[model samples]
Target chain A: MSVTSASPSHDRPHWLALDRLGVLITLILLSSFLLPFALFRANRILLGDGLPLLASMQPVAASVLLLALAFGVGAALLRLPALIKLAAGFGVLTILFIAMGLSAETLMPADNNYARVSPAAGFWVLVFGLALLVTDALTRLRLGPWTRIGILLGVCGAFWALLWSGLWNELSILKEYANRAPAFWNEARTHLLLAFGSVAIAAIVGIPLGILCYRVRPVRAALLNILNIVQTIPSIALFGLLIAPLAWVAANVPGAKASGISGIGVAPAVVALFAYSLLPIVSNTVVGLLGVSAPAVDAARGMGMTWLQRLVQVELPLAFPVILTGIRIVLVQNIGLTTIAALIGGGGFGVFVFQGIGQTAMDLVLLGAVPTVVLAFAAAVVLDAFVELTSRGGRRA
Target chain B: MKPGLLLRVFALALLIVLLVAPQAFRDFFALFVRPTQPPIYTQGNLLDITLSHLMIVAIAIGLSTMVAVSLAILVTRPFGAEFLPLSRAIANVGQTFPPVAVLALAVPMLGFGTAPTLVALFLYGLLPIFENTLTGLTTLPEDVMEASRGVGMTGWQRLTQVELPLALPIILAGIRLSTVIALATATIGSTVAARTLGEVIIAGLTTGNTAFVLQGGLIVGVLAVLIYDSLSALEKWLARRTGRLTRADA
Candidate 1:
């Protein structure tokens, strides 16, 4: 829009450049001692030591080569193409991953299985900094949501494929994954079960409660207040609170154990998750129902439609889109929250997280954290697409 | 008279009751737990822990609001419009990156203390405030903005006076959401050795002490309710003052 205002060269902003001196400086400074480029350990005792990128010749070469290209492009006094920037970012990421993998391969003793070779906080900082630069360039291109999602999936798929092909087998995180390969699928299954079960329960309970809250006058405050109160209780605290009562039920109630309702497992995890999921679903449902136009309801009523028929035929369809959006939020939120389920001995991906914490192993933590992030991201995207499709249909109607 | 005042009075009474519950019901909770241990959270002083929790939340939310609001303002400007997607992506990263993961990542760099927790909380609180501020500023009436500009008000003056003031209610709603989230999420800070209410729950989890867990949950839940109510009241007041509320009463 402001492109037409270019009377003087000074008034016009410069276009993109490859090195972007600022980005180059940032990358170098970030990869240097300002952040630990790599972590080292002798045996299982993780030493609080990090080596700069130049600590190893191969990595240093990689860094130098990358920086040289960046500097050459930047110093050429020519604006870089958007496509080139994207490709360069992709290349740099591949190089960074390979550099880390190569360093790990060389650093760890081949004979010793217990020795750990991991990237420290600095490595992560550099990765993030580079990622920010790449995303900035990508955003400047103004890609659509589907295109962005495709880029994400493509990058992730390639990385996973490389990992599966044994390219990153020597990396400490993959090693952690290697050890838990059998259990990983099971934990993933449990994680999904925890997420989906709670979402299902929340929807079943919340939709009706939402309708009731919308219809009733006095019930709204009391019901919403309770749900809000429940929501505000921290996830860990909520899980802790459920332990006693569920324990009591398991001990005293006949057939409770038979039904798999217990104090410290999926039962309490799902229950706490269900509680957490309710506020969004219920509030969204009420909001959606209330959002229906008055004239539509009036017309239905004038047509001699019963109250139930009016609700079933008119209100639900109008409200379905908003309700789906709420469910999307709940699903994504629950996916992340379910990681806490492992803290209570409820089987899920959080098992790796807590175990990693216990062992003070960052790699093990990634073993859990990465999958959870992916699951949550995927659920949010899929549900969002669903919401868009339905809402568009609603708008058309 | 006013319903807002009535709600505040009710909330205040409820708050007082909740704060006193642990001390008042120590003996009652002892029935649920074994007779050997104390029934209530007596490890770290409950009041002190609560104060620390509040302080941590306050500082984190304060920092996040400043950054988020500034970014929101920047993105809405003509110069920074290309950055709207960039800012949104950054905020999404903050939201979608699990706070626990952030804490775990932060721990190695900042070590085990409040610093890591603060980092995690700051990131977690960014999105809601940013989104709300953007929504508020961008949705201001074109006529109002034009009038301000026609009056020769500078960019800064228009922002500080016309834009922000009118957008206060919506911005406050966002801040309210952020604050509530920060309050609840702050409990996880204790896992990293931050002195928050989560310490009570974590201790209970470790030792199978249900009474300790209950005390922690009760205090946090009550605190959340009181803060939420007060913020909602503040938002309503802002809305009313700005003439945003057409319906007189609920």
Candidate 2:
């Protein structure tokens, strides 16, 4: 690699120039050495004793982990290429995950049904630090968008492969998942339905309302103000607020109860999600349409295109990326808010979360939380890619 | 009267009525209650619960603002610029992780009660403040920055007198958003045994008492809106003072 003469490192030694990757690697080493790597619990809900790295795992695994750490330090201290640093980071991370699983297996007594082994603070710190290193290397490499997405998929596939190999089966979280495999899938479905269903509905209604708002100033002001007020209400309070009104409707409205329009279940939950979703959708739509180039619209008009034709053929196409951004925001927000819906009997992954909270079973809580986070993160990355692609395409067109 | 003043007065009046004599709404609440169920939350003093809830939110927001602002400031500095991408990635990813899940996860480490709730709120509230502050700090006009340097001002002086004053409006806006989110999220802290308004709603849910649910929901909802409005007003005033009102509105 060619070094720029203006860089401070030319005047000083490379080490003195402040290596950020080295700082992260040092942090990872410190955390791995200083903190407990695993928790050994006699039973699921009880407090566990902290276990240090070597004590928590088999000797072979511990040695491998140590070797990986050594390699990371070497990569950090040396002025290695970004590509090598990235490979080292990924290798260290994979070893960390495998070692974590091995640690759990080593800690648990095979015949003891109640024994639980969970990752501790050190493990998490190492994972976070290593992930940062990998991200830093990736940023330095400056991969294209498609390459980044490919890497994302590859990382996800690695996690799937690891799990499929039963490496983490001994871990408490996986154990908890095994116990409620069916319920986990059930809740996963419910979570998706609640989050996606509401966003879909919001788009259908919000897009038209947004167009109307763009057409009429007064309605725009009044409607946006109302939605702002709605948005200000917390998810829990809004869900609770909907209960009384919907319960009344279910009691009095002829077909409401039979149609599942009750206060305490899916109906109110979906309604609340839908309400929370409208502001983002409608506002983004308006903003997007407003952002369409005036020249483009004028050209369409000059071509004798009707208003609808101009809107459909020109404006909406230009605005789709921004509107999709709004939908992405809504989808992620709804996924999170859906967890709270479990409070009112709207079943989702939150069922596991709340159930775990009630039972003081943190593994169960992780079972719910981990998946929700993964789902939301996946949605964000995929949507971000789509937004980037469409925006690029729009500029080209 | 101006709509702003009218809203303030209405909010003040409602808060006073709710605290001074909640019984004023008892009859109305009773409409939703069964004969046997209580018409209002009787398990805890509503004012005390509300105050404790506000206190929790205040502490969490205060802590988050300090840390987030400092982190943002650090990352924007020349020496710390290397960390900017990492910090940005963290703030963005953290927001996607739900507040409720964060709250639940904290329980394992800190155990139940206000401590875990505070930790969760602090973490969840960090992103908005950090992101906004970073934007404010990084987006200052290049000419203005040059002007400050041309005056022979020290780094500290430039930050304090020039950068901070110009960025205050955006920072305040971030605080407003964070506080509003904290207020809402704090309600869920009750699930982990923190003393918040959610206790009332949870009680209501368990007993099928619509009145109790409505009482808690109304108070929390109204409180959030009022705080949100006041903070927004403050932000607007700051923006106008800094001659950035139009941009702030945008």
Candidate 3:
């Protein structure tokens, strides 16, 4: 599936235009804060005073121009591969500012004031629109990495801007994302801290647990069955189960909250994410350990090594990669599932999503989703790198 | 081999205690609380959650298999390869957009019920189905088709009789994956105003009642794993029946 494998070099020669994508990303990022200013002024100029500015705020002309610019950017990103991505990015961001300028002037009165034209909101809507369209065209056109990066950044920037400003604060829709924001970080801190702690705990618990399962048949069967059962429960339920007992301890025990026995906020989220992590780590570790050849383990014993010594020296080293692979899957899945904690008052990006739904603001929803997606993907990529490193070490061993 | 039996038994005991403990909290609620007519716990409603999940899984798998097989067959012809990358990219984009987002985006277009649920389920199920179909079909022995043609079978006949039969085991694996994913994904249906197991869990979150959520979540999770395991066993059985067990070593 490698693109450069079969196609003629000349056909994909335009893949070189990717450098401009960086410029596009930078401009879009910088302009997100500036664009709102443009809208504020446009309304002031069109409705308040200034005939000259009102002419500039003309919506019909701007609408036509924005549509033309979007198509032009689409074509540039699609056709040129790397060539016009940066240029197109700037144009797209500029078109967004101009479009907003026209819309605000045409739609709103002069009294409303907000600072800096939001380049970021444009990133989500028009920017992602172009990116999604281009994602299809990129393959047909055989564009390479650079051009795609521009589109990614532009989309990300927009989502970030809207989210930061709480743009989707509307009550009727996208409300789910907004309601949870006040406790958002406390929820994030609870879960994020738990995720950090749980992964560490999982490696401790899951690896040894996996080894136990590998060494003992009945034990492995029992644990695997339990882990499998736990894994199947949707993440929401997992957090719910973890929360009840912890809440009991908080209320009943006289000084439990002060002593940190309260179950509600972060603890349950951690436990849920942790339980979710257990199956993969344990199963993988067990598989990896059992996968070590019997002859090799016997050979280590034959060299006058005791059981523990053999495990430390030969078996464990050989089993590390498979175990690591399990950990990788567990961590990645955990991050993705953790987003739902917002529902449980455990809060992460789920707040924004739920808030957006309640508030009816699509932009705020994207703010949560974009980061969660990036977080999940980043976790996956980082895990892959670790797996690659450990796997390489495993190979050498 | 059974070293952890006692530990596991103890752990299960703890799980039972933890799972059932919320009832004690409910009893406490009755002791010192204002009288509200809403029941704190109900067993029959949990059963309803299970039935709804079954329906979602059934519809999702049925529709997805049809679409996936059709797309898979379409891609086999010479012209299909040109669209293979495109199809896969579409599947990727579809998956990359969270199921929750799919639920959100689909609601306006499809209205607020089972229709949106099915769309989300179908789109969510597509990647696994398509990938498996592609893998199964492409991996078939090239000579199988030649021999069918050598015997003068038409292209359609070759596909249905020879190619598909040969590809059944791998294709079934994809079906298995789709089923598990669909089963779990049905939980999201609750948020979209569709009645499913997720309603139980979401209600638990909103009302701070862990028992209701646990009831639904536990059942849904167990069902998915069991179905996956059952299909896995069936896949192996099919492989043996088809002489793949013996042929694999060779």
Candidate 4:
């Protein structure tokens, strides 16, 4: 198929192309048409009955979505330019988001506080499919790093505007948010604190340890083995294991309790996260430093630069990108681990997740889960760009 | 005789003792629990919970391997080459989504218990296997591939006999990674009411039973390390067998 496509065949019919994008678009259409678009519940916690696309919203809104779907299918099948294909993908997505909100508004009985509406399987599948299409188009276009970040910001801003405009107020997740807005922000803060605070501390401790490991062969092997073993422990188990020791400290150790040190909360959570974080940072540092070119180091030595000077001015600078990559990994991993921190009363997004699970409130769970995902995804992208930029700059230097 | 084999045997022995006879370790665990509280997790047998946990990980890893390996193969093939970028993007992005969050999200659609947990583990495990398999298959030596073709091997024959065998070590590394991850993640399945070793940890957490938590954590940690080591050894062996690893590599 690629051979055929690569061949000089401009005269070939466009519809016969049937590229991979077409297959995804077809799946999007099939799912949107066949599966439930929205689910309507009597209350926040009850299981909702599925609603088809047409039945999910007003006729006009449904038709508008259908039109966008048709356009998406057209974009997929036709030999459109990459930019146009991208626009069609985004157009479908934007319409889908709006229609989801509209569906919730339509499905909810006016003045019925108990009524709840949420996006069902079909809605998620569409979002996923369209997102893939948009991504594929972007890849084909070969957008630069900054432009990709700008697009990310744009998409984020669009979602923010949608949220701010009260478009999705009737959606179950939004409704869950409205009730616990303050708590939501509070948990978000704690979540960020757990994830970022640990990474910050780990970097401070890990870099030097990594340097030491790089310098000392026996220590390198022993330290890495220990960290590897630590890494294998499940986050929950680690969190659980920390409880007793920290509690002991809080109780028996002077000023520990007063200093906010405890077994089950932020202290243990941060400690566990920090422990989990060290392996990546330390290993990355070692790798990055080792990766510094031998010629460069010899040149630095020839120039009469001291050992520390060579490390700071030569090796560290060269290794900065790989180190940043490690930091990126740790940051993302910590963010996810922070969710599990909620189990131990560390107070993060997982608070809502566990509470929702306990109460059987799916939307409440989403309130916790969605932001965690979005945050991890954003961090990954931003840090990936940083890594790429630095590596490129390193090459030039 | 080898250190890797010795470590594996030790871990396996310890794991079996812990699972089959909690009474043997009761005194040790009692140090952690208060005098009034039970040291052992008495709600379910340790062996049963461990078995179920292994079952969940096995099932999830098995399903994910099939799906991810197939997808990797598809995208690498000539007919499905167009999907390479898209599949890569999906795998990369999917991994950034946390396992715990994925498990929670699965609950809304699949409801409580093993089903949601299975779905979450399956999704969570896909990236490592897919990415590794993709790397392995694509990075095979060009000469070897040409040689296979030179021998008049059909596409299917080349893939099955030549490509897969040469790529087995790297692919095994991916599955090993996926399996290790699934083991850890499956413990979280208890939060969604799935039967797994997390039950012990959760029970301990809720009831303030440090012994139970330690018991669960110890078992999980031990199991993870053992499996990781064993798989790594297998990967190395495969690499050696395939001549991918020379004496210098060893």
Model 4's DockQ? 0.82
Per-residue lDDT of A243-276 in model 1, one digit per residue for the tens?
A: 8899889999999988998899898999999999
| TM-score computed on alpha carbons, candidate 2 | 0.95
Q: Tens digits of per-residue lDDT for model 3 on B1-250?
A: 2654455455545434434454544654354223552324453355455677788778878988899889988877775664576576666555545566566666534656788889988877877888877877787776766788899998888888877877777778888877876777788777767778888778766776655666567667666766776687777888777654312121
lDDT, candidate 2, B107-182, per-residue tens: 8889889999999999998999999999889889889999999999999999889988988888888888888888
**Tens-digit lDDT track of model 4 for A1-397:** 0112233446477534766667767776776668899999999887779989998899999999988888888787766566777899998999999999999988899899888999999998888778877887777777766877888899999999999999999999999999999999999999999999999999999999999999999999899989999998888889989999999999999999999999889999999999999999999999999999999999999999999999999999999999999999999988888999999999999999999999999999999999999999999989988898899899998
TM-score sort, best first: 4, 2, 1, 3
**Evaluation by TM-score, superior candidate among 2 and 3:** 2
CA shift at A209, candidate 4, in angstroms? Answer: 0.9
TM-score of 4: 0.96
RMSD of each: 4.4, 2.7, 9.0, 2.8
Off by over 4 Å in 4: A1-16, B1-7, B245-250
For candidate 1, the TM-score is 0.88
Task: Tell me the TM-score of model 3.
Answer: 0.69
- Superposing every Cα of model 4 onto the true structure, what RMSD results? 2.8
Candidate 1 lDDT over B153-248, as tens digits, reads: 999999999898888888877788888888878888887788988898888988998888887877777778778777877888888888664111
Which residue window of length 10 is worst by lDDT in model 1 chain A?
A: A1-10
Off by over 4 Å in 3: A1-110, A113-191, A249-259, A290-321, A359-364, A385-397, B1-50, B85-98, B104-111, B141-154, B204-211, B245-250
